[model samples]
Target: MNQRRQKKLSHHLFEAILTGDARSTKALLHRGASPERRNGDGTTPLYLASVQGEAEIARLLMEAGASPDIESSGPGSDGTPLCAAACWGHTETVRQLLAHGADPNLREDQGTGRTPLEWADGGPHPDTAEVLRAAGAQPSPHRAVGAM
Candidate 1:
């Protein structure tokens, strides 16, 4: 029950998510591991899955009760799991998160003053921008950098 041991277990679970190892993830959860636990950067297993565009991983995390809307708790908390997926043009990931109740219009990290729409704009991928807009992301006056 030491802190270091718990963190090690969490990190193992986190790695399983990134590798899309559903079986291991399931086993970890079944053993009462915490999927919602965050990393040093406040990145949860869901966040890693979204960023990696691993649909199975994302699904597993969601089913385990990880909050799709948990912002980074870091500066701005601007990084929603959906936004991170969108920023990477992970259409399926974005769709999954939205279906699971992630707010497309979730506010961006503070000071950055951006939205998922803005994040999409900052990327070079047109498909991502389109997907975000289609998901009801709007054009705020904030105008994310490099948005077309």
Candidate 2:
């Protein structure tokens, strides 16, 4: 596909993710919308899907090769997809992200920010915290950023 078409598909893909439209997301991705493409908010399709708790969309993005651990760029609560899901108490989304290799212990902002566990723990979500803890997430928040 041409760059123009790819760009359009990517744009539409973001809309589909935001709306939790799994069918559209899947079609767009099948037509070559990049799972790795970030929106104007600097969030990938998977990240947005996680924030929206769209587990089916997230799974599609992952199957399309979205990096589960990639951080968001736009100024927002979202850092990693895992962080987005955890903070929102999206247990299934968190589980999907972890299964797809998202780093449960990874802090946002290159490690200086909160880990998924911390995000979960701080939120009104004990179940999310439990998921992270089961995944081996750490409780301490002072890890060196960019040390990964």
The 0-to-1 C-alpha lDDT of every candidate, in the order given, reads: 0.75, 0.85
- Judging by TM-score against the true structure, name the best candidate: 2
Estimate, for each residue in 13-47, the C-alpha lDDT of model 1 and write its tens digit. 98898788888888887776676888777777787
Worst 10 residues of 1 by lDDT: 71-80
Q: Model 2, 1-148: lDDT tens per residue?
A: 7988888999999889878899999888888899998777776778789989998999999999999999888767358899999988999999999999998888788867778877787776999898888989877845443332
Candidate 1's clash total is 4
**lDDT for position 26 in model 1:** 84
RMSD after CA superposition, every candidate: 3.1, 3.8
Instruction: Candidate 2: list runs displaced more than 4 Å.
Output: 141-148
Model 2 poorest ten-residue lDDT run: 139-148
Index of the highest-lDDT prediction: 2
